[model samples]
Target: MIRRVLACSVALVAVCSLGGCGTLPGFGDDTTEVTVWLMRNSASDDFVQRFKHGFEQEHKDVELDVRIQEWTGIGEKIDQALKDGDAPDVIEVGNTQVPRYAASGGLLDMTLESLRDWGSDAWLPGLAQPGNVDGMQYGIPWYAANRVVIYNKDLFAAAGITKPPKDRAEWLADTAKLNSGQNQGIYLAGQDWYTLAGFVWDEGGELAQEGTGDWKGALDSPAALRGMAFYKQLQALGNGPRNADEETPPQAGIFAGGKVAQMIAVPGAAKAIQKANPRLADKLGYFPIPGPTEAKPGAVFTGGSDLIIPRRTAHRAAAVRVVAALTGEKWQTDLAATMNYVPNKSTLAHAVEGQAGTAAMARGAAQGRATPNSPQWAAVEADNPIKPYMTSVLNGADPKRAAKAASDRITTLLFP
Candidate 1:
């Protein structure tokens, strides 16, 4: 049996900071021990144990030892572990973080056929692309989600709008109807990079374009500036807190008051709305933000996790098997339902297709995209020039000029 290791938050951080302390969850007497590290909350203990036991059943001599890690300082911690020759057999990496490891050759390079054997064409849209660096598979997607929009049903009824907006004009028109001056409509976070990217992608814009040798910032492109202009246009329709960005996800708090007609939402938002204002919780409805074409959902920046084998693991074959089993069809189906994530394997997302909320999730997942390919993306995100540049455009600076400045900064980050 695998043991559970629990530590206080402070202790956990300290232990991780000085490189990992291995054998936390368990060290079975079995000769073959396969250790796995999972990001906290990425998967529930119950399901993980199931996979652990399943792997053991398949390989009688091997024992699976599971350890939990926090997102904070994880990259540095993992790197420390590798430096100290204490890396785990398999590690779960955030999708966006895959490039850093893959480009640095910190992960094993599995052949394309080997990856297909694990989860092939049935994989969710854009989930597998991040793992394919230079056309070699270094990681496999585990799960995914599309950030979406949630609106007040009561406000929709009051406006005589029977359905959610199907296109940009309809979206703006509905917001106009909901804005009675005492409260705002269409609560958009000014500095939120994900939603900002969504608007850009909705109009066929890109945050950065991946080049042969390095990534180039595309914010100055006509399509991207048009999207930025559209984002500015939305700010004009509704008023909320200014200077907000990913520093805090401020839209949920603003829209939970029930007076706001609509706002962008994410997973766990329903529970948050209930906590913020229980009465209006039941009135909330969800939909994918529609694209320029009414028939398709707007482009969402799909976020997800990936499973990879560290280059140093001795039991490469065993670790690969565990990754394959964990991402198998049966496990994928149950996990998607439990976590309310669009399954990394989209064919398995059927678990939630019957409901209005999850159906919208399914639709959005179809139109979703991962971030552009750039190992140095961490630098861009760290510098975070895009949000402030967006704020400048919203604050009346010329959109093209603002975009050019942001693009220049992004180019430096992506190259430097």
Candidate 2:
């Protein structure tokens, strides 16, 4: 259910005027309502306002009913609603969650011809691939987030480091200097799969690969084993809790506490850190997590929302139009400028490159990879098998054993 209104955030936030059933101008009782449910943080008021106004102009016979929904319990809520045939016309799903819904036949099949309106070619492959299932498109690329190294400049200077690490080896070299009394090196949020995926991709390894219409876990490969080793070494280099899960953002408070040297996170983390400890605001810095090579950063995994339409929607055509207008080139540009997020359209990503977060993220995204696109991937995430496995490895388990067990668990989940 739609609950709570987040007060004005950005300066250009549009004021939404409440419209009663019969109060809407030019819309009458015959007007069909297209209810759209979106998480409060997914879109800005100004962008939604423009979409509402613009869509109305295009479809005079349809009334757009926009509701702000909370992310908490959203998965259960959407699942229940969709199963009960009471789902909204259009909803935004996390990129990773698209598989679960699409594979379950909950979303409408948006064929390639129907998707050109949204500039399909402009989409970042990592952001768009999750929206695809069995060659059919069920979602469109929405705004995305990639990791960028957010560090404390004061800590770096105190540690005698004059420049950020150009590569992972350099980063590891600086850890000794940073990990002194009361201070630690990079604050590796142990539960963050996206950050871990970067190391795997950097080492030319993959978590899973599709074969014979099924995804097989490939973490046991030589390259992946190296990646796993590097990932485990990360925890030992830091002082943060090694047993944390995705449910807990371990870096938030720790970074604010003013001892951790660096952390890999979305651009919004800087805001969160400042909120936790305002005094550290000016001392913060941002950059991409350098890869093994000096020319590029590690391959960061993309995290963002994707727009999907329910199969049972009474207005599929209207929903498509609405999404196209909402994610229009102009609005997307505004989304990046105002929200500090990477636009779904890579073409527009350049516009936001000047922003430190987007710049660092863009550098990483050029080499980034999306999570394996499969329905079972969602189940794997919910189970969080890797977090525990990582914890075990950090506690002294062999990388090969942990990887093999993880692969077994994944295959069991996917097959069962």
Candidate 3:
């Protein structure tokens, strides 16, 4: 899932316009129509149909008009809707996008509902934290996805590894053993910054920090340097390019070639790998990215969607009902099962327990975190310095010097 939205710094005020009404098909004069905008590929047609059918069945007087949206230019389109009032009653935004929209004053503050009705306490922190802007809840988490270590079972067996490593030490040692004779141990790209973020988080280092309304890059912090050191060490076991990301060479294709033993990616990447090479379908395996200790998994950057209501929606109450219905256990279970996503709440992790890949992703989702809540964070990603920093350090640049340059760039983008 694409979690970053284009930077929208200006605040927006809603202008009234006609909301969803009788023009929609099957709309009756007495019926209330609630329009919803859901991102393309976010949910399957079956899941959407089930939700529409069940929601409308429960609220017979209400009509649910769900529109699928493409990701391209969605941020601008949403900004226009929020400002000009053609706004859908409910909109599904990326989990990290809440801060930008909420800052524009066009989203309803759902803190009360989140606390009283929704199980806010049990929601994944990665999704929930970004939704809370200045202590007010504006986004409702829908589902989550994160990266995990996807390994080749056949290669592991051949390498004499009986089970996946339990911690970083065992992981490093095992990876070293597997990094022999044309087999890249992990095939981790130098610019896989999300994976790097996990290592940084595991070392108790942050990419950036907020203090008294100002943000500063912390990539040069002592803990962060240690994280980079670890990344450099592990990256040496792979032959992945130092200048490119996983997608640049399409890591899935490399893994499908049957030489690489492991790769860090979403569980769904396995499907692509299988499509590319069917013979290895049953040879795949999954495990949470091991952390510093046995009981803890490495932290991961969570990517997913969150449902939010436009402040200008005429069907505020109905929109709330729609969100509640979708995030509820029955629909959540169906969505997770149908789409293979981690459920919104930690307690509902069982929704994907039957699938090994998704179950491993769920385990890591517990320690998931979001990028900086600052709306300017998108600007940082737009001209991401972290990627080059990783590449430079891997290419023998001084860690402190390379980190300082990257940190300086990040500060320029993120510092208010």
Candidate 4:
């Protein structure tokens, strides 16, 4: 009986070993261990865990090492990692920062062949544009988010507005009626790049033109001057708050608190807004941004994380697999529903249910353009001399002089 029991135990061990149940691939043999560096946000953590578990279950021979870093420290950490020779195999980077890293040779060169093999083109067109520097791909879009106009239906009804605006004129008129001593019609972040960029684009003016790498001050143009004037008009008429900072909670807080009728906000903000005021969960209505003319509908700026492979990685093949699984249809769809973000891939639409508003927002994102992908983009935005100068124009400064001053400053930054 003892001999029979021992034999049965040995048989069970052999079965388990054959299935590769206990060992990760490339552990003892030539198996690969890939390290993934991800942001330390709550949503990102959940995504990383789900992706790691799923990939590990399928590819039992592979080992995944995940390192989470706070968003504030990511840039410094990545720079330090590269110098220390401890760079991760794969990295998750913000869309805006992707260009800076790629331009500095901090990422692997992903060619069309690599993208095709990995099947990354399933995402939206401009969604993955950030990972490309000088037309060579360096990253895959993991997920995407964009801004939209969220309005209170009850407020609109109370203000006697028949419907949401389709053009700039109607938008202004509606805001005028919605404006009350207790409630502003719109909640605009004063220095919000996303909000400013929408107005800039609507006026047929670009912050910077593509390819030539020239910076002409479009902010001083007649069209841009007109747009800025309109913006100040709203502020003067009490349609929006004064002295609201773009990066703080109060901008979104007031809107969520039912003190404002309409506001420009990100898709990811929906969950937070609903959390702030539970009653707002079903009362929110979404609409595409209105522009000066139907021919030029205002464009929503795209914002999201990109999946990049580091040049120093030893597990290139495995890293590619990880990116594929993360950006796959199943993951994209699941993430969109739970996080209120749009999926990177167009095919993942079916994964999201009851999200027609998000779908419309996605279409707007596709039509949008990214800010100049130059390495100097950060410096320009940080040292934006244009804002104060534009403020002068809004307060009755000469339009041409304001445009020229802004243009000159931008040109110096771009060319210098």
lDDT of 4: 0.71
Q: After superposition, how far is residue 345 of candidate 4 from its true place, in Å?
A: 3.1
Candidate 3 Cα outliers beyond 4 Å, as residue runs = 1-29
In terms of lDDT, the poorest run of 10 residues in model 3 is 7-16
Best by lDDT: 3
Q: Write the per-residue lDDT of candidate 1 for residues 155-235, one digit (tens) a residue.
A: 889878898888888887778888876667777768877877888887788999876787888998988888887777776
Q: Residues 29-112, candidate 2: write the lDDT tens digits.
A: 556688999888777898788778877887777789999999888988998888988899989888888888876688888866
* Runs with alpha carbons beyond 4 Å of true place in candidate 4: 1-30, 42-44, 118-122, 180-182, 210-217, 221-223, 226-230, 233-244, 247-249, 268-281, 292-297, 356-360
Whole-model Cα lDDT of every candidate shown, in order = 0.79, 0.78, 0.92, 0.71
Using TM-score as the measure, the top candidate is 3
Colliding pairs, model 1? none
Candidate 4 lDDT tens digits, 1-416? 99999998798778767764333433345456788877766255676677778888898767888887788868777777766766888888887777777765767787764467656666665566666778888878777777777888889888888677887788888888888879888877554556676677667766665556644556766666666666666555443433344456455566788878887776556677788899988878877777776654576677778888877777777887787777777777767777667788766755543785686576566556567676667677777866666556555778678777877787677664
Where in model 2 is the C-alpha error above 4 Å? 1-32, 58-61, 80-86, 246-249
Q: Tell me which of candidates 2 and 4 scores higher on TM-score.
A: 2
Candidates 1 and 2: which is better by TM-score?
A: 1
| Clashes found in each candidate (C-alpha, N, C closer than 3 A) | 0, 0, 0, 4
2 versus 3: better lDDT goes to: 3
RMSD of every candidate to native, in Å, equals 8.5, 9.5, 9.4, 6.7
- Per-candidate TM equals 0.88, 0.85, 0.93, 0.82
